[model samples]
Target: EADIYQTPRYLVIGTGKKITLECSQTMGHDKMYWYQQDPGMELHLIHYSYGVNSTEKGDLSSESTVSRIRTEHFPLTLESARPSHTSQYLCASTKATQETQYFGPGTRLLVL
Candidate 1:
């Protein structure tokens, strides 16, 4: 089993609502990432963090934001939810020296 955990496996909210997607890992990996994917679509890297106090925006443009405080936890937040924001959010982690990434069960969000 993967060490990562995401809360509220599914969510549905009205437009303009605020939501926060939680992602946590117990593997103690220094590298963590957030990916956005639609059903039957390719996953896109949206954000990443190398270690505590380190973060970088990814190739995709996203309204959501992420933070890496403790090595085991990286949470993403959306200040204002919109219909275009509907997607499955996946969290993954890998060791600094290893390329194998362990993914968390995604959080599926729908905006009305």
Candidate 2:
């Protein structure tokens, strides 16, 4: 089984507060990604990393940032939270040679 995890499954914060959503995996996947989504909607890839020291912004526009300093960890951060940033953030990872992706339980953020 995949050992991916996300902390604080749910969060409620006031506007302008900085927050970090933690994501980690134990399968040693080299490719990690962060996606934004609303309830019952399609996911939009917002950030990704191929490996350590290799990070890139995804197709969608986002106010969040991510870093990949280790092969198994990819954490997303919002410098200043806002009500407009409320949504579910999902993290996924895949091996360098594998097409299948393993996803974490997801973090639900509510900017009040």
Candidate 3:
């Protein structure tokens, strides 16, 4: 299993609040992905990276931004949270040569 973790497992915040969802992995995987999903909905890829300092937007258009400063960490930040942003954010990582992605438990955010 991939040693990945997401902090603040559950969060409730007011609208317009800025929040950062933290994700970290100890497996040293070079590639990582971020996905957003609503309850019982499909997962949409919002961001991904091949390695440190290399980030790319995914198929889904998202207001959130991600940074990859170190191989083990990839945090997503929403400058202004809205009700529409209320969803589950998942983090996953995989080795460059591997197709299997190990995912974290995910952070569930609710904007009030």
Candidate 4:
């Protein structure tokens, strides 16, 4: 499994607070995915990338932005957070030749 990590595993911030959720992998996977989910709900893809400098929005329309500046780093940023943004964010990565995706421990955010 790819070694993926997400920082600030749990975050609680007030509304309008700017926040960034960090995701990284050490396995050198070329493709990465970001997903958002609420409790007991299906996962919603928020963003994804094919490789470095290549990012695409996913099926779910999100107010956050993501960047793949490095192969192992894909950070999602929200300029202004809101209560509606409270959810769990997950990060996953896969190799071009493989169908399996390795996921990181999700980051849970709560905007009060």
Superposition error at 57 for model 4 (Å): 0.3
Which ranges in model 2 have alpha carbons more than 4 Å from their true place? none
CA lDDT of every candidate: 0.93, 0.93, 0.96, 0.95
**Which candidate leads in lDDT?**
3
lDDT of 3 by residue, 3-91 (tens): 99999899999999999999999998999999999977999999999999999999999999999999999999999999999999999
Candidate 2 achieves a global lDDT of 0.93
Query: Which RMSD values do the candidates have, in order?
Result: 0.9, 0.9, 0.9, 1.1
- lDDT tens digits by residue: candidate 4, 1-112: 5699999899999999999999999998999999999976999999999999999999999999999999999999999999999999999999875679889999999999
Show the colliding residue pairs in model 2: none
Error of 1 at 69 (Å): 1.1
Better of 3 and 4 by lDDT: 3
Which window of 10 residues has the lowest lDDT sum in candidate 4? 94-103
Which ten contiguous residues of candidate 3 have the minimum total lDDT?
A: 94-103
The worst-scoring run of ten residues by lDDT in candidate 1 lies at 94-103
TM-score of each: 0.96, 0.96, 0.96, 0.96
Clashing pairs in 4: none
Clashes of 3: 0
